[model samples]
Target: MDTASPAKWVPHPEGPEIAFFDTETTVPSRKGESYSLLEFGAILVCPKRLVEVFSYSTLIKPADLNAISVTSVRCNGISRESVGSAPTFADVADTVYAILHGRVWAGHNIVRFDCPRIKEAYAEIGRPAPEPKGLIDTLPLLTQRFGRRAGNMKMASLATYFGLGRQSHRSLDDVRMNLEVVKYCATVLFLEASLPDVLSAATPIDELPITRTDTDITTSSNETSVLVAHIEEMKLDSSNAGTAPSYTTVPIIEGSSGFSGYLEPEEVMTQHITVSTLPFGQFAKMAVYHKDVPLHLCCANLNVCFGVSTKFLDNAGRPKLNIVVEIPENLCKVLDKCDEVAHKMSQEAGSISQWRPLVKKDGYVNLPTVRLHIPTVANGDHAIYSTEMYQKESSGNIQKLVFTKVDASELDTLFIPGNMLDAFFDLDVYDYQQNAGIRLVAKRLVLHSK
Candidate 1:
């Protein structure tokens, strides 16, 4: 049973305009190790028609004819004497390219191993490699379709399972068997689920050739409509704030000091404070006392205010605070545990908040967080570039924030602000103690006015 012979080739008409190909090489490694193409076979099928079947098998002449012994023993059983009189790779380049042109290449495990090796062979022969654009991997398709019910479906196993004849390792037989699988996949899975649509969606747009002018015109129109809608929505949802808050100030000095008889009196006071936590059923409030005289009170709903704050100081040194109030401690824990999640959430919130008005319907907003790698500088603070947000459909899951890279500049710029302690005063005590303080540390301080 010589499986390599072309006379045994059989093709089906119901398959796609697909080329089922298989290559037998001297060695397995695609790069580093040299491998001669021992045999190549292809079965071309159009919808309901078997167009062509081709096979090219010849011994490769090695420079050191003695080295052919290794390949002859391992791959196709042929000796050095047999290949000494055969044609070189240069002789078959045109025929191979002619057969492969403008065809959707189909092969099992072609993505991981076979396709790369074939391309490498072409490069070695001083010819351009086959375009990967038209390639279709059958392995992923099979996995997606039959992964759940049919565990570990190998090419041989799939062929056997589908009652498509045996898949021999020889090039010609493998192509025939692959054609059968392609037929089965098309009839059983593809047509039912719209394979063409799936393929189009999976393929990147730049790879497809624009053959007709109408396609370009239609694509341009669709892009313009999307841009217009986005602009209109952004206009509707513009935010009031120009920039995010970094710090906020509170007015502690009431009046300027008076000078009498070359003596000036400055108001300076220090107070000891005890913090007490109170938990309401649906909320938490923090109270700061100077011997039971309430100095500051903070309240928040756990669902809304997540115990995070951003404060900005005005020119007068007075602080205006933007607090992420009513936030639960558990959710804060999740954010702290995952820094990437925190960064992503911050980016999304900052970017999407600008267009909040456009997202009128509940859960209509889709905010996608972008992750970037920032390089670290030696001494200076790490610089953070742009933060853009994409609104997407809500996933019904907590959005994750990720910080991909910490550059030297970001490390240098990182500093603990002086007012960070005062910002803690703004957090609901009960929520901080129960939800935040358990996982995070907070220190208190008193500032004297001059």
Candidate 2:
């Protein structure tokens, strides 16, 4: 999709228009690689009336077509030949700026992706990036408001969850898709919000606990079933009102932290879930000092790459181990806020451990890692079992895993580099037994299919 006739729009006239926009850019082949702007698309939505009044879309010719990698082409189906003669971003910057400047800019994942790309593009040309009257990044918004039962928080997943079909990935198509997805999510959220008690009561117990019935030693499907069980368990725990602590708006400004003051009071649900709860049960028969009631962490897709056993040793000279997982930059930002709240909670409870910040710095977190301490119950306690791994049998019932045992060696291998596991854990700040700092004590882990 290329050029479209935009509706006539007067900037800052009467009131501002809600500019829903999206961009398609060169997919960086390597880490830290820059994204080249290849396309831009937007529609001006009337806020008071709730209708799209204008739309604009255009293909942008990057300085180097080689910037579009094969992966990029596969992602959006845009090729060099397709945009060989298209207008460069420079040619369309004026129109884009005119349409977007002073408007409330909104898009899917724009805060972490599109918004930054747009700014980077302008900066490359030594020009000022167009300013948004206010910013609305739907990624965080919807993740908090709509909840993550849709699986991964990617746009395609959200679309699929709502039966909106595969996201076209092209600039304009994605913009339109983004709008429709938001509408669907908003509608569902509205109904839920309007009747919270009714919805909560009617909500099913599908998220409840699942126990493994059989000991089948066979397939990855078994592990997948265990993961599903963990997910269901999370759904039940997360629904509790006080279990997961919510937070007020933590306004993050781009570039310098000067507040833009463009955000409308009603345009954003500033409140969000911050401090995810710990597992529901206490410390069980595990080797470590078990809390009787285990708390659950908010279920998150975490990448556990390494473990350290020597730092904090137990009475038996065996190491009190901690697993390390990389945190995504965007999510790291939200978790930082969670860290603050957790720190406050622990302090209020008279904990004296030094608080550790979740996000070391802003902008980009390069495989930011956090330690998850795994406490052992005995000197010879090598047993590390996750909830029974399960796979779907041909008959569609959850079957037990071939390998149900998860010892230290197996855990070391299972949580190796490149393993992205969905985890439910406790965000515990400990000041006991010479171990202090926030520890993500994993209560459950579902191995992610590569």
Candidate 3:
């Protein structure tokens, strides 16, 4: 490894292009293990023509070769032998910084993963990391705008969906593929936006009709069932609804952030139990979210066996409601199924809502957890909210938790964070305001003492 450190980088033109980049790192073998940088690849694209202006890619000799496990090699095909003679990241930091700093940054899921890894690399080398003029995470951006039509937002899946061949997983190849994927998706979206009626009639990209049986109920009065009323209504009115409901701007509901289909605690609980009647016997049970499976292709159902903590306004720019809960492994499998089903549906619908996976990194240890995003809608003058809050009593009666905004503000809350509760929910899909994907909609919940 080179011992000399690269000098601080200064952009000559102060960023006239969009910097698209990707990084390949050693997969952490154990919990809390930091990612070791293995490679860096980037390309500067002309914003006007959407063509590549400059490209750079290099393999980096990690600080510790032992960090590169067999799994890591399998993931990216980069082995210690391949990078043994490569330059260290410290040697190329200046070039990487120069190509990145002050430019609009674009990459697949960079905001969640790559961007952080770059910052961490800089922090390790005791240098200031590059800052972007604007950040565009293609994963969420496309998942939002392009929809899941191409399946999961992973670069490999998107490439395959568009018949762009395979993803090499190398930093340079991946970044270039990322740009191409974005262009294809943007073109499709542009065409659809320019002509909605024409596109709607065309069978959605990568989707077939889902033939759900009428065995799926359509009543709100049921105690443990899915309210298929809206699904049925959509089927009946779909001929005329013509994307109206999906983008309905019928004056945002006073308190409920414009979210419709609001259900009370009992109503929510019934819906969960109702849809979950698909019987299972031991190993024959089905799952939605599997760790090894792509999220858009699978689904899941989770049981929050622990008490929940409910709070308001914890997350900025979102509704004040949040319910944090833990997913027991047994339920994680089912919840994964919900993810798959909802993801496939969202893609077929060409909806723009982002999918939030139930099983996250650092999952499967002491029970993986997920947040129940409860966006409240108005009920007359009061702001009423549906919660992932569900209760199961000792007698086995399941109930949902309904809280008013005033009740949440009081903080003498029924669903306290960090407190365990018995809850039942479906990983249902929603496309309100073009925000699509699966969420844990509580059909049943139990609140313990105080």
Candidate 4:
């Protein structure tokens, strides 16, 4: 509650440091409810050593005590009674500003959540918010770097993955946990990076047989499919409907072979559907199969029930774009079987994440629908649409649209709800954090002429 800055303490004179911070806020229980800062905590650390040099935490009373609902207290255990006597944000504004201003900032989900909370706290006080020298939001950073072994990649989940004990959800306790989580992740990555080199030196690469089935990522007309193309292999193409074309890249085609055999939904047999694991543990892939063959199915002419959405985000802060479509009974049975098999496989693989079914029937008057993911590929430091995009004219010729840059909002204008289109997609199964389900990844989208 003290606004006074303690005497200076600098522990890393030879290296740069980052301020790892966290905030506890009022969770809006009602519509139009604004978040009020409940607590603030921060720790300064040397980036090179990942050692903390200073720490600060304090509770602040919000102007409106009524904002603290039972739901908010249950979320973080911070009640109005506890903060009633605590200093208001205005009291500790000086200390908070000094601790955060002009330094590199880092924390779990700081970019999307905490940073905005900080800005709002300052804005409410009619004061300019402190600016960081640089930013490092670990939510996106770890997602891109560490992979999703720790489940949804939240602070609590990461802590549980490392057996670091339960997260208290209090500001200072959470901030400290955030630092430890990053430290553990860095250690794991370091060890993993070194292993390949050590093993290579000890054993010649040529001597070891590569028994792992290589998932061919190329969806181009060359071969059809791979074992199950790694999501990042950015290319596109699809062969004519028959001939068992799979998702391929570079003119990324819809082939019966994209990855693990992209078959038509019409060709799938529910009784033959099953799930199998790829090589590697938590970071590995899963395959849905029809009898002995991998079941990566494609269907054409699905009606666009809903257009592009950006509600969920990816590692780089862009929307994890997808469109909703009305599906036929055949595709529904196929997807349901795939979902059933995949859910069981994830359970056998020891995942407790909530299962997300690709098919939806409840919200739309019991009409079945499936989502089609529109993915992106890295192009130097940026990403371009990975789904080969095209527009079919009313006259009947289909033409491709080339883009220099792209985003979810811009793509929104293209896939209008109720529009009819032919879609080619990969039925991808995934278990991340605590969410497991099959993803209908679109490889090629041919828009119908208006």
Which number leads on lDDT? 4
Tell how far residue 348 is off in model 1, in angstroms.
62
TM-score of each: 0.36, 0.47, 0.48, 0.46
Give lDDT tens digits, candidate 4, residues 1-450.
Answer: 222233244233223557778888875533235678898888876554455678878888999999897657867899999898888898878777877887777776565467767887888889998877666666646655666565556677777776667889888888877766665565556445569656322353343322212142112322122211211121111111111112222332335223345677777778888787787664688888788876666665665666677679788876788898877778888888888888888888888899987889985625688889998777888778888777654334555667666555446545644345777777788877877898889888876542
Q: Write the per-residue lDDT of candidate 2 for residues 82-201, one digit (tens) a residue.
A: 889888877777777787776667777565457667877887787887776566666555666566565445678777776666778777777777766666565565557669987742
Highest TM-score scorer: 3
lDDT of 2 at 53: 77
Compare candidates 3 and 4 on lDDT and give the better one: 4
Tell me the tens digit of each residue's lDDT in model 1 across 195-307: 66655324454533223221221223443444333222212111211111222323223232211121100111123434444566775434433445533321111111111
List residue ranges in candidate 4 displaced over 4 A. Answer: 1-16, 197-450
What's the lDDT for all of these models? 0.38, 0.55, 0.55, 0.67
In model 3, which regions exceed 4 Å deviation?
1-13, 201-450
